[model samples]
Target chain A: MRWDFASVFDNTDALLVGAAGTLRIFAICLVLGLSLGLLVGLGRYSRNRWLHIPATIFVEFFRNTPVLVQILWFYFALPILLPFQISPLAAASLGISLNSAAFSAEIYRGGIQSIETGQWDGARALGMRWGQAMRRIILPQALKRMLPALTNRAIEIFKMSTLASAVAYVELLQQGKLIASLNYNPIEAYTAVAVIFFVFLWPLVQFSYFLERRLRRDE
Target chain B: MAYQWDFSPVLANAPLLVEGLVNTLRITGTALVFGVALGLGLALLRLSPRRYLSWPAGFVIEVFRTTPPLVQLFWFFFAMPILVGIEMTPFMAGAVTFSIQSASFFAEVFRAGIQSIERGQWDGARALGMRHDQAMRRIILPQAVKRMIPAFMERAIELMKTTTLIATISYADLLFAANEVSQKTFRPLETYTVVALIYFVVIFLASQVARLVELRLARSGESTVH
Candidate 1:
């Protein structure tokens, strides 16, 4: 058997489209997941039972289950309860974003909790409200510590974006599947896909390591 | 129109779901045992004084860690057979992929755990006429393994969740069984929901156990490694 990449190179257009789809979903999930996570994390940190109970439940349920299951649930089961059919992208996005939210919520909570009480007290002494204190003082400091974890989460989200293909969303893996089936070159096609992912993720993984090392040194 | 919720179809397919769950555990168990053992070996090789052994181990860990598992799965399941001239079953492919995948992660944990031990301990061992391997086997590993329990449990749980990906390759894991039952019953909602809940229960219990172990470790005043 001989190794050939000519077929994969000829299908660069398909891979490019898949790359765009993967990036699109990654951006969507990053924004949705992190922002939603902040709210849920605040809920988890809240003093009220009303906020805390539901947030805890949400985190536990999503975190405990496999992400693919969540994606499948949104894709296949969710539409039955709604008036309209769900798009593959929508289903995939919802599942990935929500699942990411659950994981990142813990990061947010841990970051916030790690803040020294002295800082919170200082904010209160300055006559700042809870929201003001959190936004102006707590989050800024917490964010530095959270940066490594959040970067890790972003990488994870990028990787998880491949699951969108399970719902027939036009991601890199889905495109690879298309290319392989069409050209009958599963070896080159899948190898290309794996290399593409490694190339895309290597820098991010390095950045995360840099952040972690820097954080460890600084702290 | 109110679409009435029905679980009767899912309930009737209990046997299938049970079998799926068993397969899931089987895969998880196989992967966990091999992953930990292989992980330790990789970690030790990575920690080697020789460049050749360390470099290859580092490469394997980094490559596996860097790429997505599904891509690896596809490469192993679809791409591997042609290249190696051997037929590959889904279970075989899934097991191999996950064992190496989880092993890469476990390698890091083991490396950290081993490194976390103070240099004085090694010095003490060497001063006691213990050879490197002798010190590592008896003195270093026992303590490292204790600190590593929480991280190991967490990884094992993650591995279980990851086993769901095998379903994509047509492995009759729980998630695959869900798809089969859902199509058969024409009750996607009930079937998927049931499977999700089943996953939730099993994983939740496992997580609770992990948490309990971590808590016990903490209470016992053991410093755990991530």
Candidate 2:
């Protein structure tokens, strides 16, 4: 029950492996999630039901469900339902990426919607096509506007990577749990993991604030 | 191992799930009330002219706001007990963590709401011979609280969703109940689907209530100023 910082760090390489796994999953999910989010966001605003309804349902289903459940479903239920087998890491990444997409889609939609109607009119007045206006004029500004929300979501996605540990994905928390089980020192093991997370998370938090202030000043 | 989708086991265990749901609501409700109170105090402290008080208050808000709630919950449930030599039951630990986590966000909401009120309003209150505390109590807080309703409602919805994290610390909340059923029947899909549906109903209802409140507030012509 005593604090044992040295014990936790004795196998530092093992912990670093867990950290590397955490970073890998986070990076993969961020890229995939952001891409999917843009598609879903555009789909939500589309006039056709072909695009909008499915995107709407996807957003609602993922957004409404507990993320832990979503992780469990992908990691457990999907294999039985799917034709081929997937690795645990793949399942966890897919689950996190898809859920993050649902949220990011909403963020992008909000950012895009916040752009003024006059700006759209102004673009039209300049004889730009819809796609041209969106790509060249609207999206840049919208993306800039969404940087705060996007950074917050990225941090959230990074934190949620820990949930992958629940399904035995051997992320930082799972590694901590393994050490705790072995050593019967949950306090030290988990606290060390928490400190690791805090170290990773603190910079992102500061960066987001700095970016927000800079953006405000720019405006 | 093939997992089948089955609801019969979960349905038979309805009482357990219902009990968990009740506990979930209890934790969320209690946490929301206490969090709001703490948030208001913290918000006021942050706005205070006293540098020592406001600086620490600001730091606490920043720390809590940035860290994941799961990490905070784990630290409180595990670390605090060892450090303080006081063991908290899982329910108590979850409640305390949720309250502290919710307070940080609510404090930010409150601070924004308070700061949005024009300086002219404060000057006007001062000219009427009202002291600072009296002006805040009678004029500023009421207006700030009104302007804050929409944001506060959104935060409440978020807090409700976050209550599921209590399952991590052995609190028998809705998510925990679902996990129990899933383990018993190995029907992760069905058990979680039902759990998600329950959450959707609660949150959707809350969203409706928020809209109604927003409508009522707008009708009263207070929302126009913001």
Candidate 3:
């Protein structure tokens, strides 16, 4: 029933490093997942069968399975499929990016689809090439619309990054487990971890809300 | 060089995987029922006019939703015994934690459903001289529940997938069974692939059902509106 803050305070540096590691995992996943997802997303909307089919399979396959299973698969099995071994961080990031890419692709597709048909027509009416229109006309507006969803996915990625610990990645949750088991103070250790998550995530949630409000106002 | 993909290890351990799948479903089903019940209660509390009732409820809901479920799971399984002076089995701890955390998310969905009912619905209820509780139960809820069906189904799908977290606590759930089979057979690749496929099939089917329900809800909502 009693919580000892002293044990938690004593391991502050370790927890902070764990948190930084977590942030790094999240950052890499967000950047790579979205970049790859952008391509896959455009492929999702593509008319060609070759591009569209693979993209659909990729999205559905990743979306349907648990990210945890994927992480385990990457950690335990992926190296067997490849020539070389990967570090835990590398394996974890690979698995998470694949999962994130699926959801991110959907978010991108949603953003692109939301733009009015007339916007495309308007671009053509101005005699702009398709590439010119996509880059300068459609993309700018689509990026604005996608920000809130991307913000949401960022939060999702943050939460999912906690799974890295299960794969021996030495992330925040794993570190908390170590410190707690060592200190025999689960309450204090877990409370610190929970507080850290809340502090980091609350702002992203607020930002998503604010963006939603602003976007709704724009309409 | 060619790599061999063996299915014999997974096939040999089929019974355990099947048992694990069933356990996973059982856990998810229990959590869904408890989560919805708790969520509805919390939603009503947050919607209450009394500051004393609503304020604390909102705070609890906010904190639950903001934190990762894994942390909560660990806290409940590991810390609960020390704090509460009663030991719980892994299943019991998981059920309680997932229910509460799922309730937090479901509470928000319920709030949105209730709020989305047009203000005119309330006015109409009042014009008919219905009391607040009566109006909510008899009129507002029936429609709101219909609108909420799609969201609830989607969350159900998500919750089902989250059942895998129980494996972390050494629960002999599907993923844990997969791990054991892999270690036993020394075919980690084959075993995890099978587990992933099982998840893919189950979730894919659930999502399709959700889509169908969504379409039906959309049609009914349109008619109900007019």
Candidates in order have lDDT scores of 0.96, 0.84, 0.89
True-structure Cα RMSD, model 2: 2.8
Residue-wise C-alpha lDDT for candidate 1, range B1-226, written one tens digit per residue:
8999999989999999999999999999999999999999999999999999999999999999999898999999999999999999999999999999999999999999999999998999999999999999989999999999999999999999999999999999999999999999999999999999999999999999999999999999999999
Which is better, 2 or 3, measured by DockQ?
3
Model 2 TM-score on a 0 to 1 scale: 0.91
Residue-pair clashes per candidate: 0, 0, 0
iRMS of candidate 3, Å: 0.8
Question: Which regions in candidate 2 have their CA more than 4 angstroms from the true location?
Answer: A1-3, A84-87, A117-128, B1-6, B215-226
Best by lDDT: 1
lDDT of 2 by residue, B1-226 (tens): 5555668987988888898899989999999999999999899999999999999999888777766677778778876787788988988888888898899989989898888888998999999999999999988988889989988998888888788878877899988898898888877667777887888778777877987998898898875222
Per-prediction fnat: 0.89, 0.34, 0.73
Q: What is the C-alpha RMSD of each candidate to the true structure, in Å?
A: 0.7, 2.8, 1.9
- Calculate DockQ per candidate and list them: 0.92, 0.46, 0.82
TM-score to true structure, per model: 0.99, 0.91, 0.97
Off by over 4 Å in 1: none
Return the lDDT, model 3, position A170. Answer: 78
lDDT, residue A6, model 2: 77
Q: Which digits, one per residue and each the tens of the lDDT, describe model 3 over residues B106-197? A: 89888888887999999999999999999999988887887778888888888988889999998888999999999999999999999999
Candidate 2 backbone collisions, by pair: none
